[model samples]
Target: MQYSISQDQNGTHLDWQHKNVSPEMIDWFWSNMEKGFLLWHPEEHEPLQWVIPPKHGNLIGAVHIAPQTWSDGKRQNLYIRFEDFNSVPDAIKQYIEYDHCIIVAGLGFGEGSLHVKEPLGYRIHQWQSDVQNSNSVGVIGKSNAFGWKKSENHEQGMIWAKHAGTEISNWGLFLPQLFDLYKVVKNTKYNPFMDLSVKRIDGVLQYKTAN
Candidate 1:
């Protein structure tokens, strides 16, 4: 929820512990994440589904998976590209390369490496930052299915909302938007969905958030 991103003298860092990493991998991740922070067993809610060590967080540059991605419909934790952290200055790059992708007519996108959802059927939303920026996803969807739009009144700042006055509202708002716009079509195949705004809850980051 409270995702951290920063840079340092040695380089830029974005660290967070994961219950899905291994001792060896954690060591490798931390060694290079000069400016990254990782809290093992993090008390946050992230859509990432995997079993990593509660060790150091990963750098945007140096983590690697042998297979890259999966073809079968299974959740993947390898969205963020570890290789990009190799930047000499450690600054997070704005773009990266993508090699694998699914082929389709109306909906087709390359495996954005770090995007939350697979890009097989959804229409690509935008050009990726680079071949190594597996840290986040660009907008991805079809033209009619759930789509994203900027809120006219929106500005720049951390935001929060209360559904029954609980923090869960932050993610609840995100889940539906993803499903209705992308995942829903992932399984149900529909159109005309919705969009969501980036918001924050007590410093925690949520869908569409940039800072």
Candidate 2:
């Protein structure tokens, strides 16, 4: 696992790699959550439920609610709404090529996303507070503060950073096994293990078979 902290802001960047874990596997985990989340972090994460299930397996506009326990020992319900890389602001987009990134919001703290890049790793970016002077980025409550304010709740941000690392790191332990099983499953209605390409049309993320 690899991670970095933003010295000037309240954000965390994490990356983890697991053998044979493809982007499709990541999609499958989100498309059929609950079980995977529980497996990843049984102690801090509870079963996740869809507030609004995806349409035809597309994750954009899909909403999921997960009960999570923070490092502060506070339990909070996160309502995450999935979006596409297009939703990422230009300020951040200019830094990286996010063609296959899965963006999300409604964390009540900030915004975040999952990006799978070359050399094969899962990149996680959690912006726990406002960015580019725009409140539109995060569309949730601020009760937790998400450690955005450097002076006030920076410690809370640190806790979140460490917590996120632990969760993603745990994924490396089991995802490879799950992927192996997925490869052998036959007679399935859909192949969730196949690599899919992401395209943004008119501001919405659309998935299609990769060439």
Candidate 3:
């Protein structure tokens, strides 16, 4: 599916429509993202594990290390740190509608020493609560999830936007099914028996539907 990309003084913007996204999907994203990410987009994404798992089980201050294949075909390792939404400056907050939204921010960096390397940029993702468990929430701008980096050129920004849009769409497609399996494990005393596999259909890798 093709997603739209636009630009303004703020930065490059991408608008994607992911239908039937449930609250369970959101819960899965925050908690089991390391697993779900590869399941959703096996072609593009590499394994992303937490370098610093959430302290006290809260997302704020958690850190993850991952590598991304850029549009330029260069793979770069990224160290990302999640931050509190309240710390966002007013200038950026003005453009975001925070009411009833799951507001999240991440500080991104490329390879090299943590203190020595310049920051890649900040990522702000805000999703409306109402969009969850709703159908036909078409083109909701608040659900747009992509990082707008300060150092990236317009071309690079668009590439990232497109990549994010594709990833988000894939998650929306398979999350409900994945969430059902997750509930089974939770209910059955953490049964370690899951027969999940990825299959390629029409050149896109996707989770095989649970029988």
Task: Compare the candidates by lDDT and give the number of the best one.
Answer: 3
lDDT of 2 by residue, 1-211 (tens): 3434443352444433333344445555555565477877777988887776765445666677778897789886756666555554443333333334455554443133222211111123321212322433221101111221123245655676666667766655676567566566553333333223455577555556632
- Compared with the true structure, what per-residue lDDT tens digits does model 1 show for residues 73-177? 232233222221222111212211121111111111233433423221111111112323343422111111111121211111111111111222222233323
Estimate the overall C-alpha local distance difference test score of candidate 1: 0.22
- Candidate achieving the largest TM-score: 3
Runs off by more than 4 Å, candidate 1: 1-39, 45-78, 84-211
Against the reference, the lDDT scores of all candidates come to: 0.22, 0.49, 0.53
**Local accuracy of candidate 3 as per-residue lDDT tens digits, 25-138:** 554465456757676666677889777665323455557776668567878567776544455454454555422223343444543434433234565554444444345432
Q: Name the Cα RMSD for model 3.
A: 11.0
Clashing pairs in 3: none
Off by over 4 Å in 2: 2-6, 92-99, 107-153, 182-211
Give per-model TM-scores.
0.18, 0.62, 0.69
